[model samples]
Target chain A: MKKIFLILTISLVFVFLSGFNEVVASATSNFSISIVSETPVETTVIFRGKAQSRSYVTLLKDAQIVAVTQADPNANFEISLTGLSAGIYSFGLWADDTAGRRTSTYFFNISITEGVTTIISGIFLSPTIAIDQAEVRQGDILNILGQSAPSAQVSVFINSGEEIVKTTGADNDGAWLYKFDTTSVDLGDYSTRVRASKESEISDFSPTASFKVSKKSVKSKKKCPAKGDLNNDCKVNLFDFSIAAYWWKKSLPKKIKKRVDRKLYRDGKINLRDFSVMAYYWTG
Target chain B: MRISDLKFKLVFSFLFCILFFVFFSGNILAAHLYFKVPENLVGVGQIIPVNVFLDTGGEDINALEIGVDYSRDLLKLKDWSDGNSVVNLWMERPGSDADKLIFSGLIPGGYNGKRGLLVTLNFETLKEGRAGVSLLDSSEMLLSDGAGTPAKLSINDFWFYVKEGASKLESDKKKDSDSPEDFKPEIDRDDSVFDGKYFLIFATQDKDSGVDYYEVKEGEGGFERAESPYLIRNQRKKQEIEVRAVDKDGNERASLISFVPVYPFWNGGIIIAVIMILLLISSGVYIFKKKN
Candidate 1:
């Protein structure tokens, strides 16, 4: 009986050791991309681009909507703004996918002169993604979902100890899904992101999703407010913006670490991406 | 050399001069920079209203730096206005130095439109002569691309006459009688600025005469002249604060915030930080004494 008791105590200690329960630092999404293209042309300027299929794309001048167009089934679009006076113009493109989700606004500062058709090409909208489960048990399926340019190739990248990548295609509605099996994934932390590519153009990565490979699954909770709602008030406003502003450009120190949601962004420091995410989910 | 050859050379030289001036001169006004005043003639004892404007010749620009040169003997800068200016953020507001007024600013998203109002200057006329006002040749407009590229531009110098017998000040009938636009002031506390003290930051614009200055009032204290990012004297943060933006025309716009809560006494973070600093200093002194 004495020998059995000592054995049981040793077994309990071994099972509870720190090495067997390693923790992976959760990731926060970071993505703010700005691209500029110049077209040397006369009065008439042509903008050609690809967006989510059947999505509405609008042109903005100095934050004011000037024109709008709907993408074709092939995700191709062209907007010709005529009767334009000769001068400088700050032009931008904003999109709404079939599901009515808005993409990040892309701006182009261009100079217009008189003469030929100046075609500004290669505008590919970035993809928006989300995950169904916050955490999954080993050997279970994690479903990733999002919308992209219609029929475009979608690449999902899962990063554990080793990076696993797979490709799928968006349907005509611009919706794509990838079911990821976590059986082979080590029992550690994981981050996954996606990107979309068309004929010759590829977009930047989507918001990074973070989860853990644990013994039990945790369904994504909608009760929680959107990212950047630091006060748990279910609203993102100037109060939350100020909290992030205090950490601007500072490499988050361990003492003040993880005060923000991991899904907000984890660039080496707080930057425009963190602000962009706040703007994306702003309640006011 | 033959007489025929001399004639040919003279004719060629004349034609070349004409062509050069015509072609380049046509392009000279691509980005028109000029000054607009109430009139060319201003009385010696009156104020001269100077408004600077820029037409970007169709190029989108995001940054600008301008320095003005004027005759110190003829004009003295009485005041300046940033009202309704194209610049969204000013690195340096118009600062007067000797005979020059310099300013630098940025338009975050960028601006690409004609006749963008850059700034307004009110000069007190001193002498009766031509007040030749012009921008320094070093001034520049950078393209809006992520990369700061120089945009092609043409600089135009302006001259206005100040006559001795000129009549009353045109500004007496100033059109910018309207008050400044509404704005909100923010309240914040930061460890970096003012050593964790609370402060207020605020701004606004006047479409006509422009904003001249700001005033801040704390609790019941009399209003005092202040600038943005002002340090709060009441660190306890238990006071009502009001900020007012006064335009060049003396029109004022005020925003008020209710009482702000005092910093909590239970903030153990502050106590621990003070203790950590004290411990480090004591430890250093002890090591030095032991070494000695």
Candidate 2:
């Protein structure tokens, strides 16, 4: 009986160690990758990346939705945009799960050269994040849920006066949840951001989601928000840059030109000098 | 050999190597812009093909601003090729007045390569004597690291003997047997652009001669030679849009767009829907008053 007890204790220790190793291994395996094609042959481009299985990924150019695709069961996805002129373009992409939860959009600038097909690869979808309550009572639990790559570790950063951090892990289906006890928190506004890391790859930070910690718990959904709002869409992003790009090198009336110059650069032309101002005021 | 003789030989070798490095390293070490011209001399009146190239050494770069000075008296700038250039986009399209030319461009991402082609410039040799092409010191390169850091650079001016007997430069005359490579055109609209009007974007490259111009045609309209971002005369989306890309050699490739059109609100569907809603509201009010 003594020998049997000792054997059982050793096996339990071994099993616990195995689980701990899996966590550590996952933490170390995740990586970040960003690479460009050696030769951009064609004006047409196809973007490939990973998102949650059966989720949808969207491509935005100049602030308009250009294309969207659903990921396969394995979470692999590809989105293509063709008929591009040989020029510089700003593109933004995001992924959405079935629950209407969304990842932060990733923005990039690419110069299209006509001839060869340009392939942009290895993009990892950012994690999705949502809170259970928009106005959580100061002493209640603030529940956060999201989706990410399978078996990834999730870090939640809550900002009040200072920053409070919490950690959780995703299940095999890429779903993660965290419960934060709001006790000892001040009765003020709070913003939360999330990031995910998995074996050999890490995702971008999710967009900021803001809420108030006041007297009662209330449930709501809203995304935290850009400066070059050229379209008056309340967001300054690639979409605005494109609006300017369309007028590139084209002649404008003297009075209108001068007004634009006065507002941005007085160069009286839609040129790089004016673009510099846009870059400076960029909110994204 | 004696110890003194052996020591002298080693010291002499080391000094020679240091001298060579100090004097000749710019050609091999620093990032540089170079021109590939045909041989050392060419006949006057002939087309002098000059291809500009860049070597970034090993650094990734995103932007380049260049200024070129040529012997205006001996050579006149002629046609150029749009194909075979590695430039992603040009901030200032390449142009020349008299003897000086300037251009600037940015790559979306950084470029790091051993030999990247910039442009092919064709200049017609004039009176003949000697001609030269030089890179101005004002030219610069910017690093790709978000921050626009200046790169270490070197330049070499090229000189070629121009002989008197060369014949007139002939044009392939935008005349290639093949049209520009097949390409598609895209339509885009933005409220802040053209006061919320629809416009078109298009581009194409010919492998042999190069693209020269583009023409866009809206429904029931004649094709007009135009640039990208051209405003569409018709916004109704009622007819197919056709775009043509013409090559330097006079070959043309065309793309057409045809899709189902949506009727305007005045076309009557929305009018009837609005009438029904308004009638229902009046009936509801009458019923509510009777019930009260």
Candidate 3:
């Protein structure tokens, strides 16, 4: 009876000790992943965990492999994610060999920083540019417009193959402008491309616009003289004075006389003023 | 059961807790440098307005300088000048006081802020072409605030591009010529106008003699003494007047003469009205004759 009691107590003690050991092992084995980062962006992504893996770990979002690491074996791992957009992510680790097919996966939230939006369509930079007019004359300013991420560099190239003007930034609406140096700019097809960029990305080009600089066109028509034109030649000369003297004293029809009177005097009367006007041009 | 045993247990637990807190309680925030003004693509000659924003506990910033790297064959800088901060124009390396190419003003308080510093930079292009302006790198010294503690942190470098000019010219004529050579002879002509359009003349003067003339022609024979007295002779108007010095080269190099037309108000108006009346009479006469 004594022997059986001792055997029973030893067996019970062994069983209780084994159960306690298993509990400790299970506590260490079971793990969960928690994301300590805000979100994913073009810049960076940081993560932390309650149960981390240092021995041969792989990070995944869905099933895509993001990173593999061998550092921070227990519950802390920092994965660098540059140029990655914001999204949901999951990471997993396996402490066992191929023979032991058990894997631990951690799911966490991540956010990616969205890149800045921009409008850089039609901006030009050149020293000398032609006007859109048929004949761009010298001293005609060329207006170039473009867009960027605001406050971009803009310039105008001159005929000397040099930049004549520089603008610092765009307006609140992201529009930039620069004027042409019309002084040395001749009438020709001057070409330029306005470009803008932020960091590494290049903005789109503005449609190529050209100006035709030429000498001012001559007008075919002329304005009337202050005193009326009696002969009506395009000159204020003796021809006008002679016609006024002919109608000086004639009492013609109302409209006709009025027209004659206006020719003799500036204000419309056949007076001594009419004779004087004729005398001034008598040499003709 | 003894007081000493109880005191030992308490002390051990307290010591362990302090170590854990010391090791893991502090927050590690990241430091980043981002642009403030130009959020993106900027015009070539625009005085690049810039603001360097720092988001972190105050960092020990040492020195900051903005640099632009460009293709020598494509674009060139003439001058850079401003009263306060030095503007460095560059051909290969940036040189100060060359020409009005770039102007720099010191960031108000040297720009150590959480948001950033509003530092305005005005840059003018000497020629139009493609290039880049980079934030480059900044140097800083890490030091403890006080209490004799050493500062510890990592420094990260950042960079961005500044498009000097549009790439259309570069992409199109990339294979034409590397750098701006003498205008191609095929394209170069005595037209005096650039690109078959602009007329460029130089008013040159002798340094010592003060003799001035318009360099009408090119090569050796193009220059004619402007004082030849017959510089401007109008046959129709019988007007002859010698301009003092229309030198087309040297210090007096300048643009050729240009004219704006004069309008004869009264005379011109009368001619137009008369022409209109004559047209009316002719039309009326034709219609009357046809009716008859």
Q: Top model by DockQ, which number?
A: 2
Q: Which RMSD does model 1 reach against the true structure?
A: 23.0
Task: Evaluate all candidate structures by whole-model CA lDDT and list the values in order.
Answer: 0.68, 0.69, 0.34
Q: List-wise, what DockQ does each model earn?
A: 0.02, 0.05, 0.01
For model 3, report DockQ: 0.01
B1-292, model 3: which lDDT tens digit per residue?
A: 8896676557656654654444333223334445443434444544433333444344322122333333333234432211111111101123434432221211111222345331223344344444343333332222111111122333443333345553322212111111110110111111111222222222111211122233333222334443111222222122212222321122332333332222345544678998899999999999999999
Model 2, span A1-284: residue lDDT tens: 55446545655665566466546744542223233345644447788877776788988653345688998766678887766655345556788886767787675645566554667777777889888898999899988888877677888999977988889998887788999888988899999988887665667888677889899888875542222345555454454555666666788677556545554456667765454444433333
Model 2, B1-292: lDDT tens digits are 9996676567656655665554345335667889987666778778887888888866666667788888889989897765545454455656745345877654433455656667677888887687999999988877654344667888999988888765434444443566765656666666546776676766555555666788988877898998766777776666788999887768889999763345568764698998999999999999999999
Q: After superposition, how far is residue B20 of candidate 1 from its true place, in Å?
A: 9.8
TM-score of chain A of each: 0.57, 0.64, 0.27
Q: Number of backbone collisions per candidate, in order? A: 6, 14, 90
Each prediction's TM-score versus the true structure: 0.50, 0.57, 0.17
Q: Report the Cα interface RMSD of each model, rounded to 1 decimal.
A: 24.8, 15.6, 39.2
> How much native contact recovery, as a fraction, does model 1 achieve?
0.00
> Model 3, A168-230: lDDT tens per residue?
455433345666546676555555544444333333332234445566622212223323355
TM-score of chain A of 2: 0.64
Quote the chain B TM-score of every prediction. Answer: 0.74, 0.74, 0.26
Superposition TM-score, candidate 3 onto the true structure: 0.17
